[model samples]
Target: MSRTMIAALVLVGLGLLTGCATSKDELMPTNGMTMQELWQQGSSMSAGDAGQQNIAATRATLRRPITSADMVEEQTRYTREAANEIHSQFSRLPNPDLVIYIYPHLAGRDQSVPVPGYSTVFPLYQKPHYAMPGETARPPGRTR
Candidate 1:
C-alpha cells in the first residue's frame, strides 16, 4: 500500500511539474533580436574570416558529383574477371525446355471461359541442376 502511494505521488508530482512548464505560452525575447541574428552574433565571435571561408569551401566540395574516383577501396570489385567469375561460378547444367502449344479451349467447371491459344514451357529435367566446381563433366559450351 505504501509503495503504491509513493508511485501515485511521484506520478502526480511529474504531472504538476509538466503542467507548470507548459502553462506559459509566450516565446522568450532575445533583446528584441531575431533567433538568426543572435546565432550570427555568436558565430562571428568564435570563428575568424578564414574559418568561415573554409566552411564555404567544404560546402562547395559536398556539391560535387559522386564518381569512381571518389571510391576509397580497390577498383578490382567490378572488373571483367570478377563479372565472368560471377556468371560462371553457379551455372546451371544443360536442361532443354519443352514447349507445348495448346489450341483455344474452354476451361471452367461451370462457366465455359475460352482460353486463348498459348505455348507452355516445361524443363526436360525434374529440377534445376547446378554444376559442381571442377566437376569432371562440365556443361558443353563452358571453356573452363
Candidate 2:
C-alpha cells in the first residue's frame, strides 16, 4: 500500500476506536441545575402544602381518646409478649452425659450366673442449669 493511504487508514481506525469509548457522564443531558436543585424546583410548593395537610390530619386523629376495648387489647398483647420473653429467657440447657463401664461379674443365689462386660449411659444431672449472661461455657473434664 502507498504511505499516504496507510497513514489515512490508521488515523481513521484510531478515530473510530476513540469515538466508541465514551463515559457515562458524557451521555447524560446537560442542564444548568443539579439533580437536587431540579427536584427542589419541581416540588417546592406542593411538598410543603401536602406535608402540612398530612401533619394536621395525623394530629387530629391522635387527639381522640382510646376506647376500653382498644386498651384491653393492647394490655393483652403486652402481657403475652412479656410471658413469651420470660419463658424464652428461663429455658434450660441439655443435661451433661455420663458413660459407665461395668466389669464382668457373677451373681445369683449360688453365684453361678455369669454377667458379661458391658457399659451404661446416663445423664450427670437430674435438673438442667442454664448459664447467665456474660458467662463463658466451661470445658468438659478429661476422663482416664
Candidate 3:
C-alpha cells in the first residue's frame, strides 16, 4: 500500500513538471507568422477571435497620435498650476529651499534598462532651511 501511494505521488509530481516544461515553439502561439498572417489566421479561426479583437482594439487605442499643440497646451497648463501651488506653499512656509538634482548618465551602458527586481535610483540628501535667526525648528522624524 505504501509503495502504491509513493508511485501515485511521483506520477502526480511528474504530471505537474511536464505541464510547466514547455518548448519555445509552444510558448509562442504565433510561431513564424507575420502581423498580416496572424490577422488572417485570427479572422479565419473562431477559437481566439474575441481575444484577438480585444488585443487589436487595445493596440489601436495605444497607437493614437498626440498633437504638438495639444502637448504644448497641456505642458503650459501643468506648469502654471504647479507654479501656483508652489507659490501658495511658499507663502505659508517661513523659509523655502529649492534644489534640483541632475543625474548624468553613467560612463557606459544604457540607463533605460532596469536592474531586474531592484531599483537603479540613487539616494537624495536635502538640508532643511531654518526660519528664525537664532532658533532652529526640529527636523521631521523618519517614519516607516
- Can you tell me which runs of candidate 3 are displaced by over 4 Å? 1-47, 78-144
Estimated TM-score for each candidate = 0.30, 0.31, 0.25
The regions of model 2 sitting more than 4 angstroms off are 1-87, 131-144
Model 1 over residues 11-119: C-alpha lDDT tens digits? 9999999777853235553567888998998898758988888988899898987777656334554455865664466566778899999999888996589889999
- Per-residue lDDT over 92-126 for candidate 2, one digit per residue giving the tens place of the 0 to 100 score: 45577999999999989998999999999999898
Which ten contiguous residues of candidate 3 have the minimum total lDDT? 135-144
Error of 2 at 139 (Å): 14
Candidates arranged by TM-score, highest first: 2, 1, 3
Q: Tens digits of per-residue lDDT for model 3 on 1-144? A: 699999999999999999889877778776678899878886777548797888898899999899999899888755746555543333322334445554554333655653334225432424433234323243332111
